[model samples]
Target: MTPTPKRTIVALAIAATLALAGCAPAAGGNAGNDSGGGETPTAGGTLTYGRLASASDLDLHTQITANNAFAIDKIFETLVSFDEHGKIIDWLADSHEISADGLTYTFTLRDGLKYSDGSDVKAADVKFSLERNLAKAGPLTLTAPIANIATDDAARTVVITLDEPYTPFLSELTSFASGVMPTDFGGKTEEDYLKAPIGTGPFAVSAWDPAGDLNYVKNEHYWQDGKPLLDGLDYVFVADDNQLLQRLNAGQIDAIEQVPAANAESVDGGSATTLLNSDSWAIEQIFFNTQKPEFADKNVRRAIAQTLDLPGIAKATTFGTARAASALIPPAIEYSAADAHDEKPVLAHDVAAAKQELAKSGYPDGFTATMLIPSGNSARAQIAQIVQESLAEIGITVEIESIDLASFRERFKAFDYDFMINSGQSDAPDPNGLVTFQADPEGFSNSYWTHYTNPEVTKLMHEGRTTPDGPEREKIYLEIQQILAGDVPYIPVYYSPNLHGTTAKVHGLESLPNGSVRFQDAWLDAK
Candidate 1:
């Protein structure tokens, strides 16, 4: 069993995604007409979204993928949220304040707040939700700085005191995981809540017939007035890429995301569609089973990293929709490392140097290892074949194993696979998320894939998270990237653009730097 249940069974490593709060369209590509019909968003319509895969869980604290997170976001409202402008503002809160020292934060609930169950949303509920999530959630690390939570009913204000200053506290609170739950959330187990979730967002889970579809209805008690423009969302589960696209084309599904990297070209069949493409924070990598004694050496990981060709893989996999990822954060992150496009760094594509490193690692004759990948994905199969051919050049014989998604999940979480080309989206824009995934072996849920452990990485990630935004934080992450480059726990492959296909009728969908999509105001045009 995987140590962390929060990662979920449906968490796919192949998604071209980056995640945080809110979403913005990517800069490159055609950036097609995604702004639905110029008509004002109407109040009545059911937008049936064709998802790439089914959501295993809906509990925000446990939801791991962008699909689950985005769906859950519709049903759960956080104390804070980002506007379309990408600025964090009080969502459930009428107003909030932070002490000058940054150790104290206080917020007052918005007026006339009522959960779908008719229970009042109060300061106490915020405290309960925060306390519960901090104790048992994948996002615990982000909220670890909070020392205590206190609520004053008379003032209708909740105050949170942090053990230390956290500059990104507001940004972190805007996440789907920070969604406020009812005070009486009587779920003793995760399954308890998964069966029945209660939240105060724009929508509520109406019905979930596992094999058929999941439906969400309008939350009449939603605090926001006339928002979430649509009446409800009908998310249909479709696993096959071609079937999903066909459904969207035939109007069986209003919209669909995760357009397969390979099938992206097929969608442009002269249809009047809105193709939304965005720069993603996802980093595809060929991970090493560092838990194994044979891969315990950094030199060995570096050798494999140096042997592969990232640009060639990106070109073939994305069909010119992506750029080779030199850093973990993609071009969407226009802040610090966005400019640090380490184009073809040293030792990159150097077969001879990779062989030398392999020899130095006491494997002069190279080695033989099992490379596992999901069976149904042609893109992954192609990538696996390419990596195999490249490694063969250095005398490393890789035995490719194409397994189903279920078995692959088990093998990945168990650190049971020897070599695998896996991928994942970052949870946020700051280096904190990826750094956590890369550095700590047991702290973060995503760490299951990369069993990376280094005291320097741990320390640097801490500083990077806690440090105020400026040259210092940037310098810290830059140094951390250097460390990752040297250690090569996971080789950076390429950053692909996340795509969404829909008829010109669907509008008001946006993306964030982190690879997440929010349809808060998404509505379908009436033909």
Candidate 2:
């Protein structure tokens, strides 16, 4: 089979600036086409998928977790979506247009679109879904700039006006959070709608249990013709990685998500299974609470950053599957300075330089600090251990704390820790998704929890968002990255890769750059 083409984030950024008029459908229709000795596509088998965890909830507007987004992508349809190459393209919207001022966006729904319940999709539903997202104020509320939404039901069109020009607006619309829903939730209460939501996507929820398996059935009224070749999806929850791999190799499960890096080689070598890998938009890093007394000084923060060996940590954790990150933004996102490693060189590991930097700080002799990590994640725990050993050489004593995922989230959001290991991913393909959230002080509290701020960074972030010229915007982001490297608000460890394992029977399973697995077009061969 011919390999699919890949586009850099720069192309995606430039594409966002141009007005999309009467655009064609997104790519990836031939993702796993029968070629290279594969069996012909068949359409009536139910695929059993193994997952490490269960989704917290199916409410697209409220939850943006990986598990939830993966499930929601199939059950809901967004106005726009990213093709395999990362370009924003039309989905539910047959065509769209943007005004010269970049403040107005217009969309026309495709004819004959219907929800799983066979209800017609109209402009009013699109208007209501976007407006409701603004009111919820969730993490996916990238729609906060919308000033008003107007609909013309007769014309099947919706017009949205923003307060100002937001370059990432179109890319943000691809998120599952912006998924279209029935007006007033089909006249059902919010609680009732969430219990059994309906969408115009290729699949509908047949049964769901938070702690057990979740099942889905093909939507008979799906807008896409002769698609969703699989009869249904059976998601089996398997928390243990070893057992998950065993099941896949044993032919008990057709596919598995989140394949551990250490087991990638073994899974690929297995006769019945194959491993899928792609560049991921996520990054693993250690965040410093700038407000805390121990890290309040810039010299102290810089000292700690220089002491840890980023490349060593990455290898120890991901086992060559990931590369040491050179910038806050992952390389997959647009305007990322990740390629500037040689020129910028973000705090390369140096024991002697670290000692000198520490001597210049208020705590000349070093100090003791605690680093927190989620309890169940072995990769993070390994990172903490590596940091503990490295910092010791510089006379800084480090303590590692393991906390439950729930408690860790509460403390993380509350800014209650001195230092912590965490991984973050962009909601969209644009740099505005991660850069603005991390550097823009006016928004999300300086890197979303660090309490670190720079006046210049704040100004540049504003300029980058409103600037329409690609070259000019690139200069602004490059400057911001240089500033961030000097400030050391967070120390980037590695860029994570998206990994999945599938049995020989599975086909058409593609992983998006944002680390999402698309199963809508997947099919299975007869045993």
Candidate lDDT (C-alpha), each: 0.68, 0.78
The sequence of per-residue lDDT tens digits that candidate 1 reaches over residues 1-527 is 01232211111111113112222311211123344435666677888888755666787775566557767777787776654334455678777776767677787777788887777777888888776666665643235467888998668888888787666566667677777887657434656666657788777888986555789887778776666677888888876666887787787787887676666666655365556676666777778788776678887888888898888988987788777877655555423253464653634678888988988896778888989997656678888999989989988899999987667878887878897877756554444556666566656544546677778876776666566666777787777777777788777788767777876677777665455556656777777
Residue 299 displacement (Å), model 1: 2.3
Query: Quick one: best TM-score, which candidate?
Result: 2
Clashes of 1: 9
Give candidate 2's error at residue 69 in angstroms: 2.3
Clashes of 2: 0
Task: Please give the range of 10 consecutive residues that has the lowest summed lDDT in model 1.
Answer: 7-16
Clashing pairs in 2: none
lDDT for 12 in candidate 1 is: 11
Q: Judged by lDDT against the true structure, how good is candidate 2?
A: 0.78
* Model 2 lowest lDDT segment of ten: 1-10
TM-score of each: 0.87, 0.92
Best by lDDT: 2
